[model samples]
Target: MNLIGKKIKIRNFDENDLGQFLELVQDKNNHKLAGLEYTNDIEFGRDLLDMYRRRDGSYTVALQDNNKMIGIIELNKRGESTELLLTREIGFVIDKKFRNQGYAKEAVQLMLEYGFNDLQLTEVWASTEKDNLAPQKLLERLEFKYIYEADQTLPYTGQHNLVKYYLLKK
Candidate 1:
């Protein structure tokens, strides 16, 4: 799964991405904000391998110039059922060092194209914590209409609920 954007490339996960994947998931701030549990490199690597084998809808986001692993983006299914394929949830996490560089936006645009064009998806949705402005802005910039906000505690943050955003194929 290789997706080329203007500045970022969404590629399949591999062993070579282990080091950077650990670094991204290890950050206390990043993990907490993204609702990810803290884990050591070994556990993280194992989880990555397991998810890759599953191959539901995961991709490694990297820089195109040097092919450096910087983040991850995924289009997840609403349920385990294969029948529900057209509607997926988009999720992403950018490296702290790479934030504010427009990488996340570019990566998302590429994924949106893949979802609507290649996958023939009818709609795509994303949820962000109330306090998370970056993703909200990204979704808005991409013309994803505001759906609604749900009140549910985040296990990792335990502070705020989530706001869902939606976009239809155009």
Candidate 2:
């Protein structure tokens, strides 16, 4: 699936995307709220490539006007459900240089559409650090309701305190 909006396009991740993907993931500023640190390991990239090949979810790259990868969006099922009703979790990370441009919001909107329509999900949910205003505002703009607060710690950076959001498809 492909999702285009404004000056960005979301497409499936390719092996060719390895270089840019690695750079993005290694960016500390871009992953501040996510509590991720810089890394230069090829194994991390390979693991991500493997995840991209799974049918249960997707790893999409957000391309800019110059066709450079500026972000990534993922939609994954939280559990196995034989019935049509199911729930999914959504996540996104945008490059620091491309932030404040609404690309993450657009990418997430497209993911929600795919989750509700294509994947036939009953609800989609996401969580962010309580202090992360960008994602909180983005989720609100997408009509996701503030669900509850949880004390969570990032295993990577050890950041704690989080707020969760939920969006139910009508």
Candidate 3:
């Protein structure tokens, strides 16, 4: 699947995306802010993509002009039955170099549309580190309602971060 926007596009991960994907994960500073990581081995990167494809939830955000990947985004189903199935958790991270220039915002808008329209979701939720004002402002700008704040162990990173949660309903 591919999502096109004025400045960026979101698409399924391809083997060719490995180079840019590695750059994003291997950069220590970037993953520290994002709260995730991967090993430096090239083979490990390919293996991880295979796992991502099995779930078909993770995707790449790239420039429309050059098709160069600049970020990753995902929507993880929160539950499996009845009303719970319509809710999902969303997350994303743009390469540090491409941040603050509106790409992340556009990518998120596209995802929100997909979640509410294509997926028929009732709500999409997100949590950002309490100190990360950029995403908090973006979530508010997009009309997500504040839920609460708490200390949560990031599943992938295992880091305990003070998190502020928000949700957008369809």
Candidate that scores best on lDDT: 3
Query: Model 3, range 84-138, lDDT digits (tens) per residue?
Result: 8989999888988899999989999999999999989999999887888888898
For model 2, the superposed segments whose C-alpha errors exceed 4 Å read 35-38, 53-55, 64-66, 81-85, 153-161
- All-Cα superposition RMSD per candidate: 2.8, 3.1, 2.5
Give all TM-scores, in the order shown: 0.86, 0.80, 0.89
TM-score for model 2? 0.80
Give one digit per residue, the lDDT tens place, for model 2 in 23-43.
Answer: 776876656675433566879
Task: State residue 67's C-alpha deviation in candidate 1, in Å.
Answer: 1.3
Per-candidate Cα lDDT values, in order, are 0.81, 0.72, 0.86
Our tally of clashes for model 3 stands at: 0
Model 1 compared with the native: what TM-score? 0.86
Better of 2 and 3 by TM-score: 3
Candidate 3 accuracy as TM-score: 0.89
Ten contiguous residues with the weakest lDDT in model 2? 52-61
In terms of lDDT, model 1 sits at 0.81
